[model samples]
Target: MLDQLCHILLLVVVSILYHVTFFLPPSWVSVLRISVLLLCAAKPVSVMFTELFGRFRPMPGEGTEGAGKVIGYLERLILVILMVVGEYGVIGWIIAAKTFARSRQLADSQAFCEYFLVGTLLSILSSISLYLVLYRW
Candidate 1:
């Protein structure tokens, strides 16, 4: 209980410092908000996908769980940042770059490709929806 309280206190302090130090515009504020939301949602989303993909469309090899979760969180953060800055084109490039990097591995495995695509799509959709909700431009 004490550890949890300290951790929560630390998180609050850090979040306050981050907001105070950053010179974010209104839309960028939404980005920050969405990033936090994504961070919290990452694990639940991963579990949901694990059930959907792992059961229905199982990939052959086991992935590094922590790394994948961190990567997805970072990916959502980047997408939110890009959207807030109106760099919609960069989002496509980001996706393309990911595809290029994974092309060789994905080429040999349809199940892996499906898993990757579904996760990417979910991240993109969540980022876009958050942006639209906050800054309906």
Candidate 2:
């Protein structure tokens, strides 16, 4: 319970800091906002993801857990860029590519399918939430 509270507090603080960036000079706003967004995604969002779904163990030979973290980072970065550019439709291509890459695991293991779906949805939600917080000011 304490851990969950900390995670929620971290997100709220990050969201507030991200919004604060909007008040900076125009040139600094983009750089600062993206930096903060990426930073938040890197650690806090990962913790949130783990808290929500870490119980689902990966299948044997599924690859290193580090790789998943890297993928999640890249996924969130791409999503934030797409959202910033108003290319929401292209977001589907990212999902398609991930699905294609993991087609085998997705097909063979029900556990992996649920894990993948949950992780992907969480990643998308985090990215969109960060984007909205950063720009909605």
Report the alpha-carbon TM-score of model 1 versus the true structure: 0.63
| Candidate that scores best on lDDT | 2
- What is candidate 2's lDDT per residue for 1-137, written digit by digit as tens? 79679768866876676668667787786777677777776667888787778888575574775788789989988898888889999999999999999999899989888888989999999999988987785
Q: Which ten residues in a row have the lowest lDDT in candidate 1?
A: 36-45
Once fitted onto the true fold, the runs of candidate 2 whose alpha carbons sit more than 4 angstroms away are: 1-23
Q: Tens-digit lDDT track for model 1 on 1-137?
A: 67557657856974785667467676766566655555534554565566666665544465564665677777877887788688999999988887887788689888778777888898788778767865574
Model 1, backbone clash pairs (residues 3+ apart or across chains), number: 0
**Clash pairs, model 2 backbone:** none
Residue 136, candidate 2: alpha-carbon lDDT = 80
lDDT of 2 at 42: 67
Clashes of each: 0, 0
